[model samples]
Target: MKSNIKYKKTKLSTTTKIALYKTMLKPRLIEEKMLILLRQGKISKWFSGIGQEAISVGVTMAMQAEEYILPMHRNLGVFTTREIPLYRLFSQWQGKANGFTKGRDRSFHFGTQEFNIVGMISHLGPQFGVADGIALASKLKNKNQVTAVFTGEGGTSEGDIHEALNVASVWQLPVLFCIENNGYGLSTPTKEQYNCENLADRALGYGMESHIIDGNNILEVYTKISEITESIRKKPRPVLIEFKTFRMRGHEEASGTKYVPQDLMDQWAEKDPIENYRLHLLTEGVLTEKEDAIFKAEIKAEIDTHLDKTNAEEVIVSTESNELNDVYKDFEYQNIEESSNTNELRLIDAIHEGLKQSMEKHDDLVIMGQDIAEYGGVFKITDGFVEAFGKDRVRNTPICESAIIETAMGLSIAGIKSIVELQFSDFVTSGFNPVVNYLAKSHYRWNQNADVVLRMPCGAGVAAGPFHSQTNEAWFTKTPGLKVVYPAFPKDAKGLLATAINDPNPVLFFEHKALYRSIRQEVPTDYFTIPFGKAATLKQGTDITIIAYGQAVHWALNTLEKHKDISADVIDLRSLQPLDTETIYASTKKTGRVIILQEDSLFGGIASDISALIMENCFESLDAPVKRVASLETPIPFINHLEDQYLARDKFEDELLALLAY
Candidate 1:
């Protein structure tokens, strides 16, 4: 199955032409229905899959049911053909109840394993990672299912796409990557998008089998996709297919495409994929005008009925409310005797115990970081796990932060919930590219969770010095997709870590080394997982309030002893992402005076965010202006003495002075 723009130069049977024509007409009718729905004020927002239907319909229809389809935003054609009820599409477009994924999902962003559509991610090629993952899962399960991921020319630029490709090719994973080149990326033409004329050729770097095809021609597309998908399934290798076509419609419904050249639109519109395929079928003597008209009308009525059913649905439900339910199956937990009734299990011990338990329960749980395995991690948090779990489960990697995230992402794509450590929160800057561009936004961009866990020790107290310690939760506090957690107590350390491991979203677990072993408290040896967004209160008072997290929780606790008569309340923020302002407000409303303490530098830290939260939520409850105690904004000195002097060594004492003076 191969093709060239000049001509396919291959013979096709009349029956084959009829099947291709029918497949092409079905998607065209669907597109027409969606367009009509848009003008009727029923459909609001959507990215229409207008011109690339030939490839989408042909490849997906030719794919075996056991194999998987990981499509992109432009793959509604493929999904519609897979029997995803048109009502499901209409419900999703209108955010109505019949949508199946529930109203929580967006258009062209739904998937179902029952339909053999393993995953559909809209943020371009994030499906590459997911596609690789399903393939990995298939191999691990010894199943014969192959994974096919589709992306556009622009997606080839993302690191995640290449990363997935590299790993898939290296492992000879049963996967196919289809690149639909529509000649433009939001008006940025292919020349500006990449140096290569044909993006599939770039797959050579990863030893991937590559092909170039005429995407608008249904016959050519069907043969190529069938051939490539079959070859990968037989030999278990990765392949790349570049479909050359033009995007006749704008990037999306709301997109004006003002930047698209009128000349290109005129030329490409003349070669509309549906029309091209119709002519191809006719030239091959497949269907008469009467039969073609009847086929078009029949599909149009079917889509019209689907639209009626979808619009009649309530605006509340999704295609499947059970999406998050039982995504993991038969999880394995550590088989160990319960701890004896004893006070010896500290918070750090509890965290270790929890991770040990989780890894024992789920084979998909993986751990990796610098010195994590060989050295049991820089802080010894993961000590002795390498011997117990084996290197494949508890592994170590090189010092490259980008590579660490990339590999962990691949591991996540491989169906493992990887707990990747960055050693320190301050050093996360090295991996910021992947974290911000990929990990943090992967779920939001892909319209599905990636579930990669990033673990790092944070905070500046305990005199570890600047390079070794820092707290920068606010750096990503506002990022929408990533969950950041900075637990303050031993109990939270254990419970939060446990909860984080089970969450479907990527969690930035900032473990303060200063408190990892220093803070000791009773923790349940049992699986008493604490919720991720809740806050904890350590003490209650009336005159003033002190807010803190991580090492600052210790300082707040110690200050409580001296300020007992001052009527001060303290708050320990267990999770930074969903900051428990309700708890913070309850305490501040009682104390009236608010003060935030943080171990990070004064320039920009969680304290600033806390102050803003307090001012916004508890402004009128204040008897005085809110105050903060933070380390000075400077590099941490290597000397212990200099480091001590550099941070808020006597911050509590100074805070007390200011409170009493006020």
Candidate 2:
């Protein structure tokens, strides 16, 4: 697991050596102070990087300040080396308002955009893909910026690591995959984590050069990372560098090192990075004992001063009204001028046109998905996108949903608008973590805009079977930070999609595959935007109210047209997350009878939420109980008859009649 190839000593100037030493020493002292605070019950938790400061300081010092770094929780030295204000970082630890995440998140689980550092989510692997996106943006902008992302050896086993490596290699992005092989991932040792002798050996599988460095040696780590980053900046390719090190502390303060053998711990103790580096500095006469003592005293004093200030600051206090603030950015509806010219387009074509128009308007816009470039996607929504926008803008990704979703999030972070088309909405589950955890929560957590649109081709009726057919809007609607748009008509699809793309928050734009070619309408040729949280009433009637979205909207309209006796208000809720409550309540109170329809299974769909809302707000105006007509509670069937029997359409008319008669 050790590198046999010796590295020639790279001479450092006296000032640079002192700076590096100070950077490494600052985190050690700060963490020591934090541990004291944690033990004193002042702070909630701490993940100590007690003996692993070399990797964080060395790699951060080697990379340019303009380059991005996605640091793990243990990379406290990265923040210190980047010169982020110690007071702010202390406030973050204490969950104060001035922290990077504004007390929305605690500890190092927050990112500071001004410092060009992205903090990792609880799930460790997604930051790799986000780093790739930052590198991709650098390449597109010709900035020659290299992105460095850190992880442990155990994180190498994540699918995201593999996907990001392959993607960076294929795209020839300038990235440094910094793996601090810190002996163990929590209690799991490297012997049980992987079969490979060294984590760097896996780099060959990714078609990228690899390096193994003595992480305990600060000089070697700095030299190796500097050389690797320089080479990558010039050649623009990802390289894996495994910094062989050990975690001297538990994974977190609560976790103890009961599983680690005493002999191994004792062996690593002698190779303590800071102690060994200090000895090296003294022996070389670069730092005297008096100077080292002065540095330590200065760092300790600075940390104590900032700790007092951070503790004195008011802790985050949340109220019901203010708690909901910034879950989504305030959106102002723009009235776009439309030309008289119109085209009769299918739902898919309208979406295509909307994307083309958006891409034409926004130079930073890029579309990414599997087979979306030349294959035009499974539903052909992005058919000619590659030809219209170039391969760079129209990207085809490997079958790595989580990576691509988080990659799009990265692109958004770097001021690029991205549209990720999930081949099928059902596949969103594969990318669910990033969509819900990272992208959806980015804005609310750190005030970072994830200007990405996920085009989900959803719904059943085409008999594509269980995997491809699903109406999973209910999955994301409950997630607060995302905007969900499911348009029922071509005009609505085009307009709503345009609006979603322009929105600052992450938006899930669901397109029903069954309605792709079936629905047609006179959509405007010119660009326009339909405001979110607004429902479109297809038909206005006084007897009963029918609320639906996607294909079910068409079913409601068709059933109303077929039965002339049925007088109903057909409400198409184009946007699900920002439910059109005003329109729904008005219709419900007008008719006093309501039926909510959904193509998803009946048990836990959006219909259930809408029914509950009606009861809670419009209870006094109700004539009868709200009816929820939805698909049968089972996976979508492939057979024609079974599929029809499972869909809500088969029972929609009967349900409508019952609600009307109520």
Candidate 3:
């Protein structure tokens, strides 16, 4: 490691120096106590930060109290330095109800907004983008707050880290990207991870300043970080700092360090952060042998007292308690009366109007996606949005799907409402982790509000091939804490989108590409919001029931119009997650037969779930088995003839006739 010790010129007060020493020593002592508990089989796992006290304590102490820090699994010093209660921290490890996550999550996989600490998920890279978002919120609100996000040498390889770095640099966000190069990512060493000599060197490619620090030297780590953060707060720009350190313990207690060479361990052992800092303080006359012994003893006693209190706390036992009730916040839809004045508009125009009105209503609302600023996006839905809302609100992003989605989560964390438009619905797969894992589970895990609207332009009939067109509502509907909205007509599109933007939970809003200009209706000119989980009965009948959403709703309506003789109930399900089962069951019982339609493939689609729901609830009322009319089980073909054959539209009439005859 390079010796970048530039701490000679920086003078620290005696009081500050002693405080730093005490803060750094606390987690190391806590780790030792936790190891004893692990051996006693009282705790399940532990990620020891035995050798990494300097980076966590130094960086966190350097940051302002109002600023946020996103810490990794091993940075227990961050929690301690931030003055988090020891009893609560121990309770989290013990899975007690008093923990940060209320025992919904384990270890440091939870965040406490009260302490301005955002904890990392198991997938470490997403937090970088989330940090950028929090910084973006600060920038927008004109606050001099810098967000510090940490990752390891192994985590730098993730695409999200690179994307977040580029975004921070491009947007001039105030973010401190800290990398702890601790030699190994699990069992893989730095040599096998990346060919770059130093992870800080990668910052040059992002046009950001980079620095290397001797992470074992507490004074050096503190001085450099304090200087860097002061510069960031003044000018509001991101900087990358690579802290060259070593993990003295196994990645976890269960994962032994047998793979690490013996000589390498001995070399790192000689430079233990806490031991070196204590000796340096003693040599500088800031600490004496008696004082050091007293401090160590006091810390051990504090840990024991907290551990005893934590042991007395009750462990979470009820699986069916408040855990189920906390998955999503109750969203009561406001009934905004529609105006008598109306305009004949296409589905796309209705969505645009709704978004424009929403921006007018909420000053903190921001919409981000690729080509959304100047180009108006691929479909021109946001053509005039940038000019109206300004660049800050109507932002354009790179082709980093994961980063943008995770960034939206950060914005929500900072009390800003956001909308993320995926250029195509098919690209959702690239950003699935933040959407499904982080965003969906955040509220249930820690009561974090994710007020984000993910607008996905989906469905086929435009022949854009498989990559550009898809009906993937079923993907998000299966994930709890997400609302799925797929409106069929112009009025429904406008109203449902308005509702989605105002919702407190994450919402997946699917706009059908084929219905953009094809479907037109006289929509209310005034702002209005349609309630979710309420199916609109377009046509009322008693003979049969046709349940559908998105483009399939149009297919059902067209089929019913063509066959006037067949009386059927055509239900347009505007929202899928909070499904209107009352309307569905009423129609199913009124008519003994049902046809569920969807543009997605037949196998494992939303149509299958609805079919099963009807069978289980209204089994005796069924004249024939609940029928599902879906696309063929294959990738949507590019050729017009093959595409037509792959769609469910062609088979709708035949399936309707067969079901009617039953």
Candidate 4:
């Protein structure tokens, strides 16, 4: 069924058509280059935009540079409108350093702030949230720059899409969400995806003004986008534009696509943008066949040169070294390497002090989440924060984690470094989709890291069983871009929290309620930040090494005292992502055995990661196979005896003994 997109034809001049088609040469050339690279065994697979170039050029030409754009994998064409050079783009596809994103991400995931392009991410529905955020930030900054997000029609059903639209509508952000209905999300057609008559009407549920347009026509796309963008600029409100286009090629050009009907393909192919636009331009006398041939030859020559340059460039090098350097341009960690002079403050006091110092030091900092304003938050982590920073800065949000994270992403894009409290780590799952798909992948995708800090309480000992007692680090341990820092001591807590707020990437600052007021280490007299991924050896020994993080660090500290004969080294793997294989190996080589400790389920925990790394790098140095100590597979029960029987210091000691005995 054809969409009632309210399309009107305009007689574009020959010069206008020629100029637009010439501008599209780069993306079309890129599509052709994908075929050359694929045959040479350079690129494994690709998604060609051979027939979909006009929609991107039209939308891009309609927007200003300062306006935010969240692109999909298929919108690599949109990226050319950004400043990503063709050689660098080919290098990315060939997996090289000079590539657009420094090779931290795949070909489809490169963008830069130089283009006002918020990164291109691949989490089916989460880009909508980021688009909403850019819009929110525009409103907050009082800037006229609207945010444009490009996605597929298949992404409409995901909860994140609705969450983002609803938030954007409620906040009335200046965002134009463009859904490119390319008919197939991999194999499934639009017919199989949703039951709605038109995707735009779905926006009405969120109170957003939505319209559909002929995506294949450059004039139609540009005209409607211009009108909607103007509306966003004039009134600064959210609008949705559903582009009714067709995917001429398969997703990634690898699978024997069992989806997308042959008849639909043939029909859409008949309306192919590249071919149709060529005919239209020829009919309007935009160019003679001679001129068209020359233009095509020029595009091919340019693409060939780019491919040659890419293969000569460095390929698949680690950007891990580049991680720390490019992330923070001006934000510096407050270095405090002095002796501890302050008394051990309670966990609550420590949290308050750390946050106060952070917000004071950085004016860009903002705090938001449920009950985090004048109410001082559920755990009172934000006590007296609003009085210090005002309600606008220290925000209290509705009981919605997804909305809170989406808003934080928006604020971060607008120059606010947000510290969002998740109330309890258990509730983080509500926002977990964005964390892994958006927050974690944003930097790798766009090359511009949108920095947001998350502070949440996590652990299993405070009787908040099942729902609240989960050790949530495992959820994001394997995620690429995010940094998870778990501080065990009062000293480490303040330092790590300060550092987390300062870092440019999303940092999960996990705090323990059990240690909030009970256990205390000598904290610093003043504010300071401990660098991320730096492991600290609590106690040194020769028989076995115990690797622990967060609350388990204290447990390991206690277990070491109980087993002096064992003489084990206690190493804290504080930062999770850049797992310190160096420290783990050094300790393992000396001790001859390794044991990873955690308060969560041992079946799938951080301990498994430690085991894998040691086996990969320091396998020959081991005296025995590395063992793991963690909670049982079942959820934390309300009964103290049942919980204690499964997880704690004794369980850790038993695991260590088992490894030693082995």
Answer with 1 or 3, whichever has the higher lDDT.
3
Candidate No. with top TM-score? 3
lDDT of 1 by residue, 1-662 (tens): 11122336556667766777787677777777777777777776656678888888888877886677878777776776687777666776777766545555577666664576644444555567667656766665676667777888988897667767776776577877888999888778899999975788798787778889888877778887777777666678888889888887778767767778899888777667777666655565566778889998888888878777865665573234244332222223322333444344555676677788778877768787778886887767789998899876776665556645655654565456878888887788877766666665544333335567788777665676666777777778777667788887766776677778887677888877767667777665665467766787777777777788877777777866775666667778889886888888888888788888877777677777788888898889888888878887787776777777776747667776687578
User: What would the per-residue lDDT of candidate 4 be over residues 152-217, giving only the tens digit for each residue?
Assistant: 888887887887787777768788888888877788877789988899989878778988888887
Candidate 3 segments whose C-alpha is farther than 4 A from its true place:
1-9, 319-321
lDDT of 1 at 54: 86
**Residue pairs with backbone overlap in model 2:** none
- The Cα RMSD of model 3 versus the native structure comes to 1.8
Candidate 3 structure quality by residue, lDDT tens digits, 1-662: 32222235458899999988999999999999999999999988999888999999999999988899999988999999999989999999998977888877888899988999999899998999999999999999999889999999999999899999999999999999999999999889999999989999988899999999988888888888999999888899999999999999899989999999999999999888878777777767789989999999999999989899999987677667566788987677798978989999999999999999999999889999999998999989999988898999999998998999999999999999999999999999999999999899999888897899999999899988978877888888899889899999999999999999999999999999999999999999999989899999999998999999989998888888889998889999888988999999999999999999999998889899999999999999998889999998888887789899999998999999998887
Question: Please, what is the TM-score per model?
Answer: 0.79, 0.98, 0.98, 0.81
TM-score of 1: 0.79
Report the number of backbone clashes for model 1.
20
Report the error of model 4 at residue 386, Å. 3.3
| Ranking of models by lDDT | 3, 2, 4, 1
C-alpha RMSD for every candidate: 5.6, 2.2, 1.8, 5.0
Candidate 4 local lDDT, residue 199? 94
Model 2: per-residue lDDT, tens digit, 445-518?
Answer: 88887989999999888888999888999899999899899999999999999899888889999999989999
| Better model by TM-score: candidate 3 vs candidate 4 | 3
